[model samples]
Every structure is written in C-alpha cells, then in structure tokens.
Target: MRRATSLLCFLIVMLCGTVAMAASPVNADGYYKGIKLCGRVKVVEHFADIKVKVVDSFPDLRVKVVSSFPDDVGEWQFVEYGEDFTVQFVESFPDIKIKYVNSFPGVE
Candidate 1:
C-alpha cells in the first residue's frame, strides 16, 4: 500500500508539471498550433480564430500593431478583410493574454 501511494504521488507531480508547461504558447518558431503569431489580424466580436485578453502585466505575448510587414512574432497589422487570423478581445478566459507594446514584440 505504501509503495502504491508513492507511485501515485509521483504521477500526480509529473502531471502537474506537464499542465504548467502546456499553458505557455512561447516556442522557438513562435507558432501556436500551426498558426503563426504574426501577420495581418482581424478583430471580431465573435467566432474568432484566437481569443486574446489585454493585460498590463505578465503577458504571454507582447503585441505591436504595425502598418505593414508583420513578419516578426507578435507584430500584427489590422485588416478589414483577408486577415491571416482573426482575434476576439475578452475580459476573461482568453486563449492568449497579450500586452500591447510600441516595440519589442514577441512571446514572453
């Protein structure tokens, strides 16, 4: 019974660690589930490809709005149509939390 309890505890710890790592979208390629983090973005009220929350601190991504050439990670160009991806702003339960920055845009 003691050995079984130890094994169960170890499994729980490993599962918790996995959950923490899976929460962050930051990666070497800056892509989340094959969606590039940069490019033309469209803001929508509903049915968005990505849901983002604006936060003052501890942002998952630092986003920069650009006129053109949103090639870098977290650089986004607002578009009316033909957007690379669509996003919805929400007060809670965002898919990714973002901080708007003038420069140095990227995943944190």
Candidate 2:
C-alpha cells in the first residue's frame, strides 16, 4: 500500500507540473502576458515584446489604430517612442495574429 501511495503522489505531481507549464495566448482578463492591449505601440526590428502577424480575416484580435486615448482592448496608437509595448511583425511564427479594423476593435 505504501508503494501504491508513492506512485499516486508522483502521478499527481507530474500532472500539476504539466498544467502549470501550459501556455495561453492571452489572459482571461484581456491582457497578453500581463501587458494591456490598449495604448501606444511601437514597431521594432528586433527584441520585441510581442511578435505579431497581420491577417486579413479570422484574427485573434481586431486592432484599430488611433491617434490618442487608446484605453480599450485592441486600441493602439502608433508612436515613435515611449510606447506601452513593442511589436515585431513577422510573416510566420507570431505570438498573436491581428486584423486591422476600422470599427469595433477588440479581442476576438
């Protein structure tokens, strides 16, 4: 019975570890890796916080580029510096996929 208990403990530990290591694309509260989706965003060549791919349709988020007051999900203003987050555009292997929308922008 002691050996059986030990085996059960090991299985439980392994299961917990796997679950903890699982990665989600975004947080349940509409944040990506603890960074809020709204605000000034900067495009960078390298060492970006997020790698993004622009899609014509079926995107993970619908982004609307605004001039100011990016206070909601998927509302971003392009800026040269002092950005809330930086993104690198890539054709493949993106952290998140987005679509440019004129209206009603948010996480999809």
**Candidate 2: deviation at residue 87, Å?**
0.3
Supply the TM-score for candidate 2. 0.75
Tell me the tens digit of each residue's lDDT in model 2 across 65-108.
Answer: 99999999989999999999999999999998889999998876
After superposition, candidate 1 runs with Cα above 4 Å error:
1-22
Separately for all candidates shown, the number of backbone clashes (residues 3 or more apart, or on different chains) is 0, 0
Error of 1 at 84 (Å): 0.2
Candidate 2 at residue 67, lDDT?
97
Which parts of model 2 are misplaced by more than 4 Å?
1-24
- The global Cα lDDT (0 to 1) of model 1 is 0.89
Local distance difference test, each candidate: 0.89, 0.87
Pairs of residues clashing in candidate 1:
none
The model with the greatest lDDT is 1
